[model samples]
Target: MAIRGKTILITGASSGLGRAMALSLSHGDNNLVVTARREGLLRELAAEVEAHGSRCTVAVADAVDPAACQQVIDAGLAAYGRIDVAILNAGGGTPTNMAHTDSAAVLRIMRVNFDTLVNFLCPMIDHMRDVGGTIAWTGSPAGFFGLPRSGPYSAAKAAGRVMLDSARVELAGSPVKLVALYPGFTYTPGLDPNDVPIKALIIQPERAAREMLGAIERGRSHHMFPKRIRVLIALGRLMPEWLRRRFLRVASGG
Candidate 1:
C-alpha cells in the first residue's frame, strides 16, 4: 500500500501522465514493469527509473491487445516473481465532433480508451485476486458527464467507471484493491493547449501523476483531482438538464 519495495506494472509508460508516474515511483525502492507500443520511450523511461534507484523492466506492447496485456503481466511476474500493484494508464482522446464522426471513428476512440483498460484490467484482476494487490485505473472527470465535443470519449470513460464500480462491489471480499483516478485537463504531449478554454485550469503531468500515485498509495477507491474541476463537476450535476446542456455547449466553444 505504501508503493515502496513492490513490483508495479504501468501501461502507457511511453509518455504523458504514465511516464511522469514512472519517474515519481522510480524512487522508494520500487520494481517497475513499464509497457507501451513505443520501444524507444520505454527504454528511456527504464534508464531513468534505474537511475533513480529502482529496478525497471521495459515491456513494449499495445494495451489494446488482450494477449499483449497478458504478456506484459507475465513479464512483470517473470522479472519480480509477483506484481503488487498495477496501473492501467493507457488511454487517449482527440477532438471529435460526434455529428460528423463515422461509426469507425467513434469505435476507434472507444477502443483507445475503453478497450485498453479492459484488456489489462481482466488479466490483472485474475492475477491480483489470489496474490492480493492494487489496480489503479486512469479515468477522467469528463466521464462523470457528457461534454459537448467529447461524446465518445466521455462514453468510454463512463463505461469504464461503471465497470470498475461493479468490479469493486463483486470483489468486496477479495484482497484486491481497485482504485479509479480522474484527472482534469493535463498538459502533456498529446494535448493541444489552444483547445482548452481556460489555460489556468490545466495542470502539469507531474502534478497529475503525483496525485494519482498518492491515491494508489493510500488505496483510495476513487480520486478526482484539482479542486476547480471537482467543483465544476459537482455544479454540473446539481444543474437542471437543460441548463447543464447550455453550460456544456458554451464551455466547449460550440
Candidate 2:
C-alpha cells in the first residue's frame, strides 16, 4: 500500500502530527483531504500540499462535532472518487486535577479524542468495506496507563487502544485495515514537553509520522513511536494493578 497515489483524509491538519503527515505525503500523486477548525490555516495547508504537484482539498471542521466529522468524510468523497487511508488524528490533552476537574472540560477532551474516532469510524468502515480503505486511530502512551493531571486524555486514549486492537478480530481478512498509532511525548507546538516516567528520548512529530505511514503502508496492526515506550507499556501491563497505579502517580507529579 504505497501512499504515493492513494486518496487519504487527515484530521487536525492545522498543526502537529497531522500537519507533518500531510506534508510528508504531499510529494506523491495522492489526493489529500485535510481538515481542521481553522479555515485560514487549512487554506494555507492546501497551497503547500498542492505545491508538491498533488491534489489537496481543505475543509474547516471541528472533529469534536459529529456534523463536522461527517463533513470531513463527505468533502473527501466529493474531491476524490475513493478514499484509501484515513488518519483520525484529532485530539488534545486537558489539564485537570482529579480533586475537582470540570465535567465540561473532561467531555471536551473525550469528544476530541474518542467520540471523533467513533463518528468517523462509521463512514470510514462503510466506505472501506464497500470500496476498500485503511483507518489509523491515534492512540497515545497515555492510553497505556492512568496518570495524574491527564486523566481524561488517559481514559479516552485507553479506550481508543482497546477499540483499534479489538477491531482486527471483527475485520479479519477484509481489505480494510484498522490500526492504532501510539506516540509518546512526540514534538508538537506547545506540547513538546509531554512528561512521563522518563524525561529523555522524546521524538519529533515527523519521525513518528514516518513510522506510522510505514506501518500503514505495510498493513501492520499497530505502530508505536519511540519504541522504548512501547516496551515500557508492555512491562506496565504485566505489572500488578497497585504497582501500575503507584508508578503512574510517581511519574505524573503525584
Candidate 3:
C-alpha cells in the first residue's frame, strides 16, 4: 500500500533515521504521530512536518516503558482515529568490550534495543489485527551475528528479528504486515564515525529512510540494504565458525 494519506506512528522521531522518515512521509499527506523522550526535538520535528504540509502530533514518551508506549498509541488513535502504519524505530547501541563492561551496561543495551521493540510490538499487533495495518521494525545487519565489541547489541537485535520472524508466520492469514528493515552502518548521531572500520559501508540517514519507506510501501517481509552489507552477510554465512570469528575480529579492528 502507498504511504500517502495514512495515519503513521513513528517512534524515536527526535533524531536519526526516524526524524528523516517523518519528513519524507510528511509530503505524502500523511498523518504522523511522532514520539520520543526528547520533547524539544520532537516538537521541532512536529513543526517541520507541519511545514511540509502534513498533520503531526508530538507525543513525548520513552519507548522502553510499556505504559508510555501505550500512551503514544492512544494519542495517535485519538488524533487520527486509526493508525494504518507504525514504524518501531526507537533503539540505540554503544560499542563496548563485553569483557570489561558491567552487567548493567549490557542489560541497558538489551532494554533499549529489545525491550523498546517489545513494548511497542505487543500493543500494536492487537490494535492492527482487526483493522489491518503495517508494522515495520528498524533492525540491523549486525543482528545477523555477534560482532566484536557489540555482543549485547547484536543479541538484542537478533532477539527482535527472530520474534518478528515468528510473528510474520503467525499472522500469515491476517492482514497485518510485519516488515523487518535491516540498515547497514548508517551515519547517524548515535553512530561514531571512528568506530566504523570501512567508510564505504556507511550510508546517510536520508537514504536509509527512503529504503525503509520503500520496504513498507512494497510490503516486504524482510529487507536489508546497501547491497554490500547483504553480500558480506551472505559470505559470512558460508565461512566456517572459526574462520568467521577470525575475520570478524580483524574486520572490527580486533
Candidate 4:
C-alpha cells in the first residue's frame, strides 16, 4: 500500500490533472511512465520527474490506437518491469451541441473516450492480474446521468463506471483493484465559471490525485471527489427519470 516505491503509469500526462499527479508523485521512490500524443511535453515532464530522482519514461502514442496501447504497455514494462498502478486519464469532451457534432467529430470522441480507454486498459489489466496491480479510470460527475450537450461523454464515462465495477466483481478474490476517479467540475483555468459557480470548492488536481492514490493503496471499491458533487449524483440517480431530466435540462441551459 505504500506509494513511495511503486511504479505507476499515467495517461494524459501532457497537461492538466495528469500533470498535477506527476508533480505530486515526483518525490516518491517511484518509477513513472507518462504518455500522450504530445511527445515534446511528455519528455519535458519526464525531465522534471527525473530531476526529482524518480525514474521517468515517456511514450508518445495516441490513446485510441490498439498499436499505441501496446506500445504504452511495452514501454512501461521495459522501463519499470512492473506496474503498480495504471491511471487511465486520457480523455476529452466534445462541445455539447449535437448539431456541432459532425460524423468525424463524434467518431473521434468515441475513439478517444471509449475505444482508447478500453484498448489501453484492457491489456494493462491482463498484465496487472498476474502481479496484482490497481487500475483507476478517470470518470466524471457527468457520467452519473445524462445531461444535454454531454451525450457521448456521459455515455462513455458511464460505461467506464459500469465496466470497471463489473471487472472488480469478476476479480473479487484477487489483489488486483479496479476503481473510477469520478471527479466533479474542476476549476481548471479558462473553464466556464458560470456553470460551476462554486468552482472554488473544486479540489486541485494534486489533491484529487493524492486522494486517488490513497484509495488505491487501501483497495477502495471506488472514489469520487468533491463530496457535495457525489451527494448530488446520488440524489439525481434516485430522482424519478422525468424529474432528473428536467433538473438536468434546467441546470445545463438546455
Candidate 5:
C-alpha cells in the first residue's frame, strides 16, 4: 500500500527505468531485491541503495528465463522472507521493416517483451497469491493498439495487457495486486529515437519511474503517463483503421 518498509523486487535494474526505480525507492524502510543481465550495474545500484539506508540484494540473471526468475524470487525470500512488490521491467524492441520478415527476429521480440513478463508473472503470482503483494508489468501504449512499424512490440505488449487483465479477474479476492504500466516514449538506455519520430513525447527515465512508483503505491490496476501520449492513444482508438494506420505511419516515421 504505502511504499515504505516493503520488499520491492525489480527486474532490469541494470539500467534505464529499472535503475531509476531502484534509486527512487531506495529509502531506509525498503528492502530492494534487484536483478538483471548486467551484474556490474546491479552491484553499483546495490551499493547506492544500501547507502540510502535500505537493504539491497543483487541477483544477476536473465528475466526471460523462468528458472532465473525463480532464483530472483528465492533470493528476496531468503533475505527478507517476503516480497511486497515485484516489477517485471525487462523488455526492448527494434523498429520493424516490412521487407525484412525474419521469423527469428519476430520470436526474439516476443520473447523479450512478452515471454519475459510471463516467465516472471507465473512465479510471482504463485508466491504472492496468498501473502498478497503487488505485481507490475512494463506495458506500452503500443499495446493499446497495434503500431505501424513496431508490429512485434505492439503485439507482445498487447498480449501482456490482456493477460494482466485476466490475472486481475482471477486474483480479485487475493492479496496479489496486478498492474499494467503503459509508459509512452521513455528515454532510457538502448531505447533511442534513432529513426522513430517519437521524440516529441519522450520523457526521462527518472520522471517515468517516479510516476510509476506512485501509481503502484496507489494500487492502480492500470496506469499510463505523460498526458500527451494518453491523448494520442485515445485519439488513435477513435480513428478509422485506415486513418489510424496513416497516423501511425507518420508518428512512427515509416
Candidate 6:
C-alpha cells in the first residue's frame, strides 16, 4: 500500500534513518507518530512534519522499556484512532573487542537491538491482529553472520531478523505484513567509523530511507541493499570459516 494517507509510527525519529523516513513520508494525508528518548529532537521533527501539512504526534520514550513502547503506540492510536504502519527503528551499537568487552556491554547491545523491537512488536501485533497493518524493522546485513568487533550486535540482529522471517511465514494470509529490512553500512548520525576503510561501503541515510520505504510500500517480506554490500555479504556467507574470519579480521582492522 502507498504510504500516503496512512497513520504511521516510527521509533528513533530523533536522528539518522528514522529522521529521514519521517521527513520523507510527512506530506498530504499522513498522520505520523514519532518516538525517541530525545524530546528536543523529536519536537523539532514534529514541527517539520506539521509544516509539511501532515499531523504529527511526538512521543518521547525509550524503546527498551515495554511500558514506554506501549505508551507511544497508545498515543498514536489515541491521536489517530489507528496505526496503519509502524517502523521499529530504534537501535544503536558500539564496536567492541569481544576478547575484552564486558558482559554489561554485550547485554546493552542485545537489549537495544532486539528487546526494543520486541517491546513494540507485541503491542503492534495485538492491536493489528484483526485490523491488519504493516510492520517493518531496521535489521542489518551484519545480522546474517557475526562481524568482528560487533558480535553482540550481530547476534541481536540475527535474532530479530530470523524471528521476523519466521513471523512472515506464520502470519501468511494474515492482514498484517511483516517486513525485515536489511540495510548495508549506511552513513547515519549514530555511525562514526574510525576506520576509513569501512567508509567506502556506507550509503547516506536518505538513500537507505528511500529504499526501506519502497520495500514497505511494495509489501516485500525481506529487502537488502545497496547491491554492492549485499553481494559482499552474500559472498561472505559462502566462504569457509577460516577464509571468512580472515576477511573479517582484515575488514575490521586487525
What TM-score against the true fold does each predicted structure earn?
A: 0.98, 0.94, 0.98, 0.92, 0.96, 0.97
The local distance difference test score of each candidate is: 0.92, 0.83, 0.93, 0.80, 0.87, 0.90
Model 4, 1-254: lDDT tens digits are 26788899999888877887887788887899999899998999999998888889888898888998898889989887889888888887855667666777767766778887898778987897778888888888878877687777888888888888888888898868887887777645423556563556566766776777777677777788778888888999899999998987777766
Cα lDDT tens digits for candidate 2, 1-42: 258888999988898889989988998788999988888888
| Model 5 lDDT per residue over 1-254, tens place | 24889999998889999999999898736999999998999999999999988899999888778888898889899999999899999998887764677989888899999878988899889998888899999999989887766789999999999999988998899989988898878888757677447567788898898889988988899889989988988988999999998877776655
Superpose all Cα atoms of candidate 4 onto the true structure and report the RMSD in Å to 1 decimal. 2.0
Q: Could you give candidate 3's per-residue lDDT for residues 1-254 as a string of tens digits?
A: 25799999998899999999999999989999999999999999999999988999999898888998999999999999999999999998888798799999999999999999999999999999999999999988889899888899999999999999999999999989999999998989989988888888899999999999999999999999999999999999899999999999888767
Question: Candidate 4: misplaced stretches above 4 Å?
Answer: 189-201
Q: Identify the superior model by lDDT, candidate 3 or candidate 4.
A: 3
Q: Name the 10 consecutive residues with the lowest summed lDDT in model 1.
A: 1-10
The TM-score measured for candidate 2 stands at 0.94
Clashing pairs in 6: none
Model 3 backbone overlap count: 0
RMSD of each: 1.1, 1.7, 1.0, 2.0, 1.5, 1.3
Candidate with top lDDT is 3
170 Cα displacement, candidate 5 (Å): 1.2
Ranking by lDDT: 3, 1, 6, 5, 2, 4
